[model samples]
Target: MKQWLRFLGPLAILAIAAFLLRDKMPFLAEGYQQVLDANNVGLVLALIVTIGSMFAMAEVMRLLLMAGGTKVSLWKTAELTFVANAWSSTFPGGAAISTVYQYQTMRKWDVSVIVSSWFIVVSGVLSTLWLVGLGIVSILFLGASFSIWPLLGSATVMLGIAVLVYLATTHPKATSRIICSEVRTFNRLMRRDPERWIPAIRKHVRQLHAVHLPRRRFALIAALSLANWMLEILGLWLCIWAVTGALPGLERVGENPSFLGVILAFVTAKIVGTAQVTPAGLGPVEAAMTASLVAVGMTASSAFGAVFVYRILAFALMTILGWIIYLISVARGGMKAGEQS
Candidate 1:
């Protein structure tokens, strides 16, 4: 079961993606029919944003991986991260595959799992905090009309990260002890391999000064992450515009308050639903998305179309790209060699 995490992880993410999509396409198609203006410029711009966001996201992941000492190239790191990301959205368990893959990628580059895992966790957590923190700010400052719930919601997310990071960094040994003591089977194995995780976590806590977060570079990554989310959200907004043809009230983006909610729902569903072993978030995430859209004040049909477009843009395309990259690595006949990378 533990070993299967590699393969099953991707499957789980895909499952959620699929679950959320149930019976949504038809309704979305109908919505598209209703609003057929197809402003070539808006759509083209949206596409450009989508591609830029993907690459920007790649940089964020690369930094995290490199922090672990994997020393992977930007392009190579980006490819794996993008593929794994698409996989993660579908299968709940897919994160494990992505995790193991990250370790493998770093091992190829002569990095330790200890460094890789800690780096991945740190960067992933920090990046998320930044995104959620920004969302909260936008809601509070720019999104004045949005419900306080959304604003509060964003603040809470960052707060959660702050607490976790403090606990993990301040007390790696105690925390590691807890996991060792409480997790039973899992704890024993991890403890057995000190180099794999424990030491790095302890070091992360003790030597905080060494992990210098360069201000200019850090700011760029944070900005890129923010842009990634913002552009992705805008893409969904444009899809809605394409379907409705009527410009949703200017306030809709800020006033409706759900621009964040929909993104939240999609990411949440993608993350949580990946637990399933399905091919992609085929069922769980789709269902979650629809429910989430309704909560944010969108008509069911409109929400359906918006989600449909998002899935195609974020998932379908990503899967193809991921597979292509995976295949290329295989064809290069360097799977083992690359794993060291």
Candidate 2:
């Protein structure tokens, strides 16, 4: 009964989300037909790119885990990433849901709390920083003047995190002491036994600090992270082209949207959609994406057409894929494979 209840919350949220976004159903329907009628070759290429993006993300997790000295097979990493993305994208506050799932799942591979926490935090920070970097490049490519402050701020945060991680490595004992102290304080406030938690916290932190990857490995992960975003951007571009028949440098009658414009629109929608107020940022993402496309010179109708198709191909289709894996994994065992072990 408890296991079943865990599934109900996301189902309810998805039902409500679908109901709320009924206004876009018409566009979604049209977009569905548009994709169906697109050139066979172009459609196939877009699907391939979209599929690659999923694997690229899975690789990010694998690399992060490897860096932390947790040796897991790539297949397992991909499975976990698929489930995490599916879980997180399915409900409100899914990020937290996904984080908890990932932590629990990694524990099966003997990943300690400190290492798992570092993997989550570092992967998230790197991915966000990578997105901001892409956004900056997209802004520049659009040949429009925009404030650089946000990019600067994000870069600063990324650098700060790197420095802190390095400092923790250099002084693991001190770092563990500080973190364990905070955990004990919080535990005390919650009327828990600080004595019971502090040792475990310190041990995990010290272990986490000891497993640092080389600079070369770090660079490779960074490259993989950026490639993941680029592949996703390519998926967006292909969707727009499929809808409007507009390539990067090609001019058409009444619809000549540049590839850079679509790229910019993609970045903007992502930034706006991270809130996850609705399941997978349903209404807000489509609205913001359509508006940004229009701002970048596509007609409003064409903009909506493009965004509708993109979301269908990217979010909706991926969600379906994730759920299929989710069901299979759950039936094979449970949320964490180690539980079966």
- In terms of lDDT, the best-performing candidate is 2
Model 2 agreement with the true structure over 55-80: per-residue lDDT tens digits: 88777777777777776766777788
RMSD of each: 7.5, 5.0
Cα lDDT of candidate 2 equals 0.74
Question: What lDDT does model 1 reach?
Answer: 0.58
lDDT (Cα, tens digit) per residue for candidate 1, span 1-341 = 44246434654675565456645656544545443545555566656667667777777766654443344556766776666665564345666766777667666665554555555665565656665555455445433343556546755776676577546544556766665444455556666543455454455444432233455765676676677777776676666565445444434453242455556555555444546655455556666776666665677666665566656666667666676777787787633322324
Point out the worst 10-residue segment of candidate 2 by lDDT. 332-341
The reply for model 2, stretches above 4 Å from the true place, is: 1-36, 143-147, 177-198, 250-254, 335-341
Q: Pairing residues by index, what is the TM-score of model 1?
A: 0.64
Candidate 1 positional error at 257, Å = 8.2
Clashes of each: 44, 0
Q: Each candidate's lDDT (Cα)?
A: 0.58, 0.74
